[model samples]
Target chain A: MNRQELVNLIREKQSYLCVGLDTDIHKIPKHLLSHPDPIFAFNKAIIDATRDLCVAYKINTAFYECMGIRGWESLQRTVDYIPSGIFTIADAKRGDIGNTATQYAKTFFETYRFDAVTVAPYMGKDSVEPFLAFSEKWAIVLGLTSNEGSKDFQMQRVGEGYLYEKVLKTTMEWGTPDNLMFVIGATQTAQLGEIRKLVPHHFFLVPGVGAQGGSLKDISAVAMNADCGLLVNASRAVIYAGNGEDFAQDARRAAQEYQQEMAAYLAEKLAVKQ
Target chain B: MNRQELVNLIREKQSYLCVGLDTDIHKIPKHLLSHPDPIFAFNKAIIDATRDLCVAYKINTAFYECMGIRGWESLQRTVDYIPSGIFTIADAKRGDIGNTATQYAKTFFETYRFDAVTVAPYMGKDSVEPFLAFSEKWAIVLGLTSNEGSKDFQMQRVGEGYLYEKVLKTTMEWGTPDNLMFVIGATQTAQLGEIRKLVPHHFFLVPGVGAQGGSLKDISAVAMNADCGLLVNASRAVIYAGNGEDFAQDARRAAQEYQQEMAAYLAEKLAVKQ
Candidate 1:
């Protein structure tokens, strides 16, 4: 999806929510285990239940990858099942040399048809530039991640600012806001405002909400731009809300609540811009 | 494989050569395309021909993933087909949060049973620790990459040293040389001696030999240690050496040349240590 199209979807849905499909086979409802493809079955229900409540679906590739070939089959089916116009993200965290990265771009963007794939910037510009080369497709580079490990190297002092700051600044020169976004953890709400100032036009995919204890209100308050340039992702807290037969219904309820909260945030932010 | 086992294999083979199975469908001989599983067929031939010439086989997962479910099947079969005691590497530059990284570790180590997997360190310690948690398995974290883009952030000044230097220093604290290694490109031969000083005990997986213009002689000169702490990888230059019926033979010939060159280096390094 392009920048304008994603912004329009945020406005149309009144929510910048990106539902993360970090669907683990072990965590899914036991009743579905008998099914041929349990992970896909579980994902089909979740997509059907909450497709309208969010603007995007971020599939964490690790969950599917753990299952091997069958997992990849489920991943292909899940991507095919999601309706178009809603942005899709392959949360693969993939990056390599230029040529190898091009193969990765083809894997996610061409084969799986995701709107964007999250990329690690440790290998630098060439590893990331391949994904951005695809038109309308996006490469969400890791910035200030929500995990405790983020302090290891990302927050290290680099020259006048943090390493992530250099990442955000130097990477922006490689691609425009149209084809690039940053994965800014919602847990880092304190730095959201400052991050916004650095790359005001680019979108931020915030993934630390809900189960990770990131506040939607705090993140949206400081991070949202005129176009509502934020994709607040909630994975476990929404999808695993229930373990019974009515799990999909429970997921819907959780998603609706987040959408409602996000709607209000959108209203306040949009009103301020006007 | 453990450090002792790997060191023993290096000595037994007298070559620290890692043959990269970056098997691409289009790149393989046309005759193999008619086979039910061309990729697996191609990989099996290459493995059978060069298995003795190299101590390790690094499967670049992107090529397999590009073909989707069938690609994954090929990957599973290829890994299963390799002879025992030869080290295996899943060159999948994957990393995420703690829980997610656990899934990745399981995917490569438990599900596929790879000896080691390459991981991107952008997310830091928690992202990388899960891979190290596996017994006898390895986490080859990206240090100084060979690509042109490595100059972007890796070489950037961070505190007293480069960002890659801090990565090498901090990441060493997470795991011992037994379970941890770093991906230091052969193109960065100038920094090999310095990097060896920082993490002398840990092994280094060096790529960018042939097809990428990295000299095997230059890399081994300064990088080899007491245990021959280096696994220099050559992908396209060896695997794609011939395009006809003699492709496997050609690949074997190419690998033999690298093995021969590496044998001399191993002898000199071992002699100096003795």
Candidate 2:
């Protein structure tokens, strides 16, 4: 999960897809419910089906945490199950004061062993700096989120630019492209190019592509950098593609489609210096 | 708990003190390490000693989450161990996109049975609204943090006021006083009066009172309203007051001192309609 390694991942796979495992119990196939840990069994299937189709897996911690201790057990199993070569992200939007923030950093980076954990920048530098301290580990700070709530503060005027613009600019100073990335939503592709210009070298973990309805072609066209610095995440669109017994195969089909499309984008857009 | 219930608890106890359980294994007395669940054991002792001295207990989730599933077990036991009338807060500081935010709200409110969960407002209204959707549960949103990093985005100019000011103003619109509160850090007592004016009715969960160095006297003078609308939190200052065989007694003494000061404030400032 260093900068160079991520670059190599996209280049080697010809895909920058970061499949998001936002596995909710209520939404999963009923047959899997009888399994001791349905969340893990489902995730295991998804990872097995699509590991080669993507460069990374982003586990949305909220989904697991809702189930309480058992949910964490599921989360533990899922993170452990994901292959090491594929970069893993705990998309847990955690932020707090100094020492407490360090504990959160340890939760994801040390205990769960995720390559990166998404951080909220509202608390500012100290809340985020703890995540960047771990070598090769990453802190994907929220920039322009895909949700409707993004307009509430992110799009507001802050000095000369929008609040998210300030966030991207200010946060880059805290950590280099190696240990830091921004969660730039794909739904707001209008600002993607502007954001790309603002933080040229840093990777963007784009999360609005699939279920949230952002065209992958549009995002890949504008956002991909010389290093192929983009991790396009698809959560519900891929994982919940089908609810049948062959759900894993259905998920595989969806992932393969994304990978194939991303491969095309990689061919046209990626300009890695070999 | 509802606002009335919380107010009644404060009136009955004559203390707005929130004993923060930021229990770290390394910080706990070595004698407790022999226990099966040392974190829970330490927290039990502290709670047994100080349950009468405080109106609420804020479990800083980061401390428990760092230990993973076992850590969550400790959290479960500690929250369940607290007496029924005392308020419980999962100081998780979690925020995410809409549906995901609902999951976090469920994690803290439904699963954990916390009366309130601290939320970061960087994602805006939708992220915070779900936490308010619960009947009596509360969302304690971050307004002005205590750390030096608070100067970063929070203090920056946003239109006519600081970013944190806009956050306070805009976020209040999402939830009523019953289900919403703001974390107004105590160190910045200068802004307490101004923030009190901006957010008149809402309860403010004030940290930085003890270990982080904020005056309980100043915060109460400016921030206390008709309902004694403040929960002054002191984690390390109360929980880790001593590291010996009589640690619980020492914790009780520290908590008693805060409760004593708070009791006086409750008499002077708390002006209930009854």
Candidate 3:
């Protein structure tokens, strides 16, 4: 999906909500276990339940990768099952040397058909540039992550600003607002406004809203741009909303609540712009 | 494998050589394409020919992931085909949140049975600590990469030291030398001596020996500890040594040359210690 198309989808839906499919087979309802591919079945139901409520779905590749070949199959099936026009993200934090990175670009973009794949910027521009080479596809580089480890290197002082600030500034030069995005944790709400000022036009895939204890209101308030340039992701809180056979229904409820909250945020932002 | 076991393997082989299986389907000998699984077939042939000379095999995950399910199958088979006691590395530069990192730890260490998996440290300690939790398994965090892009964040000055230096110092606290290693690219020979001083006991998986134009002698001169603490990797130069029917034989010849050079380095180091 192109920049204009994604922005239009977010506008039309009144929610830049991205439901993260960090599905764990063990966490799924027991009834679904008997099925050949429980992960895919669970994801299909969740997509069916919440497709209208969100603008994108982010599949955390680590969850599927643990199952070996079967897991890979489930990943392919899950991505295939999601409806088109809704942006897809392969949350595979992959990066390597130039040629090796091109192969990874082929894996996520060509083979898996994800609209974007999260990439680590530690290896720098060459590692990330391969993913940005694709038309309409995106390279969401790690900026200020939500995890405690984010302080290890990302928050360390680099020149005049933090390391992540350097990452955001330097990486933006490699790709435009159209193809490059940044994964700025929603937990870093204090920095969101400053980050927005840094890269105002580029979209931010903000993970850590639900189970990670980030406030949706706080993140959306500061981070949303003229195009509602933010994809607020919620994983565990939505997917495992209930553990019984009505898990999908419960997940839909959780998603609807987030969508409703996001809708209000979008409306308020639009009204302010007008 | 533990630190002692790896050191012993290097001593027994008289080489700290790591053969990289960066098998590209398009680049493989045309004759092998007739086989049902050419990637695995090519990997099998290469392993058979060079298993004794090299102490480890580092499978670059990108080449396999690009092929999708069949590629994953090939990755499994290739790892399984390697003889026991030869350390296997899934050169999958993966990192994410704590929970997600656990799943990745499971994917490479538990499911794939790799001895070590390279991890990008842009996300920090939580992203790395899970990989360290697995007994005898290795995390192999990226310290200084071989690519030109390494200069982007890694070479950026942070306080008194460079960014990669801070990465090395901070990440070292999360895991002992037994379960943790750092990828200090062979291309950065000038810094190897200093990096060795920073983390004297830890192993370094040094890539960019041949095709990327890194000097083996210079790296070994400064980086080699008493245990021969280096797994210098040469992928393209060694793996794609020939394009004809004798490709595997030619690969073996290329690997043998590297092993011979490494053995000489080890012998000199041992002599100096004595």
Candidate 4:
């Protein structure tokens, strides 16, 4: 999906929400447990319930993989089930040798039909560029993650700046804002201002709100780009809002809350653009 | 497999060779293309052909993933087919949020039953530490890659040393040598001496040796540790050595050449240890 279509979808729904379809079978409702494929069944219900509230869906492949082949089938079905207008991400953190990585790009973009894929930048541009080569698809590289252990390397002093900053500056050269986005976790709000200065024009997929205790208001304030700048994801809080049969309804309510909050951010973004 | 067992297997086969099972459907023999699952058939042939000659099997998930559900099934079967004594790697290059990575570790280690996984360290330790938490399983972190684009950020001078060097030093603390390893490309042999000094005790999974033109003799000279700490891999040169019906036989021959060279390295390693 193009950036403008994403912007318009957010405006039309008054929501900059991207629901993380990180469907773990054990966490899904008991009612879906009886279905031949519980994960996909739960995912379908959640998507149908929240589609009006969300503009994107982030499918983390690890949960599906934990279920093995059956889980992958569910993931494929879920990807196909999502409406064409919404953005789809194979939230696969993939990066490796170049030729090997080129095949990964092909797998997600051609085989799985994802609009974008999250990439790890430690191996540098070759690892990330293969994902960028696909026309109209996005490569969301990890910038500063929202985890306690980020201090180990991401925040360490590398050169004139922190390692994350060096990664941002160098990786920006491999792809333009149109195809390259950064994964700036919501908890790292203070660094958002500094990250924006490094690559101000690119979009960011911000996670760590809700269950992770990151403030939506703070992330929007500092990390917003001219294009409304973020897809704030809330996984457990939104998806497993209630584990009962009304899980879908509870998920919708949770998503609507984030959408309403994100609406205001997008409105501010539109005002600045005007 | 424990550290001593892995070392013993390496010596028994007279090889530190890790055959990359990057089984692309199109690259396999045409006879297997008609099978219900082509990827698995191809992997089974290659494994059965070269199992005795190699110490480990590196399964790159991308090639199998290009086939979607069927591809994942092949990946599962391939992992199952390899002998228990040999090291198995899910070359997924995965790293994400901590809880998410914990699930990934469960998928590869618990579900798929792999001995190790190649992880990207850009998101820092939280992205990688979860993978290291599992006992006996290893987390192979990205160091200096062999790709041309590696110069983009990995090789950039950062204060006193390169960014990758800082990654190596900082990430070393997350796990011990028994559970942690680094991916130092075989072509980057010039830096192996320095890398050896940085993480002298840990094992390294080195790719790019044969078709990528890396020298086995040189990497062994500079990167070998007291444990014979290396799993030098060659994908295309070994697997695609002959595209005809005798492809598997050619793969065995190619693997033998590397194994013969590695035997000398192991002997030298024994001398040094004594």
User: lDDT of candidate 1?
Assistant: 0.93
After superposition, the stretches of candidate 1 with alpha carbons farther than 4 Å from their true spots are A272-274, B272-274
Off by over 4 Å in 3: A272-274, B272-274
Cα lDDT, all candidates: 0.93, 0.92, 0.93, 0.86
Model 2 alpha-carbon drift over 4 Å, by segment: A271-274, B271-274
| Candidate 3 per-residue C-alpha lDDT over A211-257 given as tens digits, one digit per residue, 9 for 90 to 100 | 99999999988988898889999999899999999999999999999
What's the ranking of the predictions by DockQ, best on top? 3, 1, 2, 4
Q: Which candidate gets the maximum DockQ versus the true structure?
A: 3
Give the poorly placed runs of model 4, Cα more than 4 Å off.
Answer: A272-274, B272-274
DockQ of 3: 0.93
Global fold similarity of model 2 (TM-score): 0.99
Chain B TM-score in each of the candidates? 0.98, 0.98, 0.98, 0.97
For every model shown, what is its TM-score relative to the native structure? 0.98, 0.99, 0.99, 0.96
| Residue pairs of candidate 2 with colliding backbone atoms | none
Clashing pairs in 3: none
DockQ of each: 0.88, 0.88, 0.93, 0.72
- Model 4's CAPRI class? medium
